[model samples]
Target: MLNHSAGIRPQTRQRVLDAITELGYRPNQAARALVTSRSQVIGVLVATRAAAYGVQKMVYEIEDAAGDAGYRVAIATCLSDDVSVRDAVDRLVAQAVEALVVVGPQAGVFNRLTAHPLAIPFVMVASDRHDDLSVSFDQVEGARIATRHLIELGHTRILHLAGPVGWVEADARMRGYLAELADHGLAPRPVIRCEWTADSGYRAACEVLGTTDVTAVFCSNDQTALGLLHALHESGRRVPQDVSVIGFDDVPDSAHYRPPLTTIRQDFAVAGQRAVGMLLAQLRAAPPPPADPVRPRLVVRDSTAPPG
Candidate 1:
């Protein structure tokens, strides 16, 4: 019998551990759960069908962090409109997850989740509501930085290609863009609200062609910027020669864009780890440590320059 309370000889303990290792012995999770009244599992609900770079990277880090904390992760994915947030939570709760982590910018998630309250603690990722246990890269600040860069490059007539409505991140980024322009005493130009896709961006840019006298454009995301670039190219407007373009969430392929993208770099891994850490604290009945929103940096590239 291996007695943990009674001090066993070190040699004996080592031999027992070696034998367990050699036999590939594993602990009985069911028995442990019975004793502790916990499933030792964390549920992650992501509101995206096609995971983008930031979402994909953050999920990876969250899984690693949860593993380090001696818990398993169960993931549930739902579309923005196809599946309701309540349905996703019900699925996770059915699995007996000890805690929950919701990821993405769907603002309606808050009210929906509040309506169907769960006994388990839940944390949010990449949300504008900081009053709760949430982790996010400051979207507004990143937008401000991107917009300010274009401003400093001598482009006063700047246009913002905004993200879809009802997204917390989209609202924050738009707020940042407005604030930056106000600080510089630049008049707010037309804000083209579009979907977060290259196609939408291209279409939006086309609409701006004959209507606006914009010299620079800040897209909500890298994909949108890519489309904007395509539109400019097709319209015989040389990038940085005719107009400067900037984007947010420096995705992996941003660096390889025709002109390489000038965008904001988010530390998704760090944010992921933080969100997981908060979940772990709840599991242990420990107070969560104070965490600040992750700061984003500007990556200067060929896509932006002083306006001609």
Candidate 2:
């Protein structure tokens, strides 16, 4: 046991340090927890159907940041089902994590967590704003930028292949799409909601491509855009010449798509860092001031052009 109040001689401290280093000694976590009443662990809760590139990237950053802060991360992945999030929370609480960084969709989770009020500090990355403990990228603005890009290229009959309902990002993107269309005085087009997968996008695109009066389509994410591209190719349509497409989440592969994909880029790394910083602040009893959201930017590529 090391005592800070009764100072030790410099030589004694060095000897202990040298002996520990030579012995390759490691601290026993159980003993340390008994002394400090802390687990030195941060719990991470992830609940999503589409654990896409952005979510993966963000989780990596969060783990990195937490490690740098002298804390280990305990991850719990939950399904999109009703009771899974609560179960996930229960598991994390059982581990006695000092804080939590929740990523992915947590629709009803806020209420459940609030009602229970786990005394530990937590930061959630999702659609709902939680006073100051929530952090999120601006999905609505990202969608607006994607849609405005198509409109700038003179695409009138634009269709939005949206993400499934009950997702906050999906709702925000849908609202942004509708807002942009309304701003242009264009009648609202019926949105086709699909899972955030290439297969779902392919199926949706195949069903709507030939029948609709659409010359442009804005997909919710890059995977969906990839599927749409494949569908368009099979349907005897030339990208940018006959149809224009835009996507969200400018994923790594988006730039390498056949004609390349025009999409919105969200800085998942920055968002994760910010969320971790906030959680750290909460743990340290100091909350950071409200900051601007991580905004998404549009990257134009060969996939989009003026409708022929």
Residue-wise C-alpha lDDT for candidate 1, range 1-308, written one tens digit per residue: 33374767788888989999999988877777788888889999997665778888999999999999888999999865534667788899988899998896777776667676779998889887674488877888999999999999999999999998888878889999999999999998878898889999999989887678888999999999999999999999988788899999999999999799999998999989999888888777898966688999999999898988
* Candidate no. 2 TM-score: 0.92
How badly does each model clash, as a count of residue pairs? 0, 0
Q: Which residue ranges in model 2 land beyond 4 Å of their true spot?
A: 1-23
Give the TM-score of each candidate.
0.89, 0.92
Worst 10 residues of 2 by lDDT: 1-10
Pick out the ten consecutive residues of candidate 1 with the lowest summed lDDT: 1-10
